[model samples]
Target: MDTCKNCGKPLENPDQELCPACRAVENAKARTRREEKAGHARRRRMNRTTRKMLIAVCVLAVVFTGLCVTATVMYDKYNPDEFIASVDAALEAGDARALKNLLKGEDLTVSDEGAAALCRAFTDAAQREALRGQLEDQVVDGGAQGAFPALGVEKESVFFGYSRYSLTVHSVRLLLSSPVQNLRLSLDGVPRTGEQTADGILYQNLFPGLYTCTVTGTTAAGQAVEGDATDLALLSSVEPTVFSGALPIADITVSGCVNDGAVITVDGAAVEQKPVNGVVTLPQVAVGSTIGMQYTAPWGAVTTASVQFADKTVTTLAFENPVTEGGVPAAGELNTLLTAHYAAYLDALNNQDTALISGCTEEYKAALAQGVVSDTHKANLYVMGTAECNPAAIKSTAADGTARVSCYVKLTYTHSDRESHEETPATAYRVYTFTWADGWKVSASADSTEEAYNTASMDALP
Candidate 1:
């Protein structure tokens, strides 16, 4: 038997190296060594795993700390109160460049002058407070509000779940109308040339605020005039603000009279010493001055009602030949002819008697006769009206001795159908041309396009 090298144990048989008791003790020692070795290996592996877990936890802690720090810094940067404070500081210092930088919008272009005007608008303490309140309200309510309202609040960017806000601004437009020509308009010392439109001139991209509006222009008579409207506020962004200038002078045209004896008068005083032509130009008449015409006949003097000079560039003054005590017989003769002709025309239409129509030209009579014959088979059409010439309308005589007269005819009559009778009131403005061949007889007649006739009331007609 072989003996144990270190323990010296006895063998149990011939091939054994040690005795039984000694062998048992040696086996126990060997088992103890093996168990100790295995325990050491387990301790080493556990040490390695613990080290790895500690390293991972350290990395995670560092990363979380960094993220929290970055989040805090971003929150500070985008703080709404701080942002509002910066804007208030710029406003207090009247720093236009700073304010311009703070303002943001789409397609927003602000000039140096416009920015300066904006700064001036909010220089007052009350205005600044109001603006600050609007900004704060936007933050709280998430909408725009207040008198001096902003366009809206905008979210510019986000960082770490933090959002940045920006206040937006918009430019206003102004619509201006002026009777003065070559108009020069300025707002707060900024010159503006507006585009011409159908309604008026349009000045675009103006800053909204209280401004001193200055306007200058050249009158039709080459007169220089200027006007100023202070504290003209343009705050709305929806519609174009309108401004009008009160000019000093206006251009006037006198018409409706061909009589060489008629005199043009202004404010009850004669403007022209000599007789005025049929159509005369009274340049640079003072605004608010009443213009009229005076015609002194052999019997009495007649003056047309005066009209005031206002914003109109060109005004027409109609000369009237009202019925005086013993004035011209042309008006009376025309009235008599129209009264009889109207009666005869109605009789011819209702009774089918074409011969009743007189005081008309031969062609007109023939036309009436044809119409009466054609309408005989239709419903009974009755016509009755009062024919009165406008007293303030034109009564001009051509060089060929033909006279033109405009009159307003009001018709109130009844017509009968097969079932019912209806009475209708109608109005007609007609121009009658008279010739002196046989007498003052109407040679032609048509609808009047005269503006004076259309505007004249029944009380003004005779």
Candidate 2:
């Protein structure tokens, strides 16, 4: 057995060092473990740094996507014209609340567009001042009332700032109202002019795709209002409809005597009096507004009416209740009863029989008596021969109860046939009347032979 030369030790098997060699081996192994532990710590630190970098990159990507979404939403809501339109609608409606809401917390000076808006909303000084307190940034009192609040617009507002707004730029140019009044506007984050005009506003430089536009303007006396159109393609054509004139009124209900008279007024203008059939026609009207009317009957009695007219339409009028003289039914029903009675009377006169003319009223008999010759009035004998009567056309008086219906007629007589056939023509006018019990009667007769007829008057006759 061999042993370490430096150490005296009991050898086991042939070669051996000392009994403490096992402890030495253990000490060397511990030293190697410490070196490996140091190397492993270095690797773990490097790995943690790589992980932190990857996490930071992911977070940044998410933030960027969110920002993009928010920007897109905000862009969709942008419109250049809405800054001024909120005032117009409120003014037309005369709404106090809307006028007040538009002025709330806004930092602005009175502008030309704002002045016009106020003028359009209120026509009078008192009304305009009240509206200003509600929505105006400042109230300018022109005590003289000589158009002191006139709008002042600069020449620059007529054209866009760009050479020509291309259809592909979506960014907006909020043109300030000319004279920079109460409205605030921005064009690409810069301030410009402020003004309102009839030519309207144009927004260009939009992406070549579908888009929505909203225009809002408010008067100092108007409330905040909004308007928007959706799904409007950027390159698409746009058209709007327009109408003019005062609104129409509803059809009126009228009823009264036709010949008696009535009046028709449209838009407060008196047009006609005593219209036939109680009919009045108004000119066609536009949709969406109230119309006023007045009516006068015969005798100058008047009444009033109104209606909400539809767009592009006409109003018709009808009589409510019609009254006539003699307590007769309507003219239509009177025609029927009168027709039958007159037909029977004509037949009886042709037959020349006493029984045939029996239905004639006592008044008609008296009227006939007045026509008899004065000297032959009491003679029972046939002094004149055959009596002849021909009916004539009917006429009505001025529609008052004093005047009823009168007829023109002719009568002749043959005292004797001197030479063969002989005929005489007589012309006269007779008045017809009616009573509850008498049914129909003759009131008076005035013949064309007035001179001779007057000589035969009842007071003059024997």
Q: Pick the candidate with the highest TM-score.
A: 1
lDDT of 2 by residue, 44-143 (tens): 8888879888888899999999878766654343322232244444555655346444432112343334333333435444643543343222212222
> 190-259 in candidate 1: lDDT tens per residue?
7888999987889887766567888878654445777746557675677888887555666677665545
Alpha-carbon lDDT, every model: 0.66, 0.36
lDDT of prediction 1 = 0.66
Q: Supply the global lDDT for candidate 2.
A: 0.36
Clashes of each: 8, 38
Instruction: Flag regions of model 2 displaced more than 4 Å.
Output: 1-7, 10-237, 243-257, 265-279, 284-317, 324-374, 377-402, 405-462
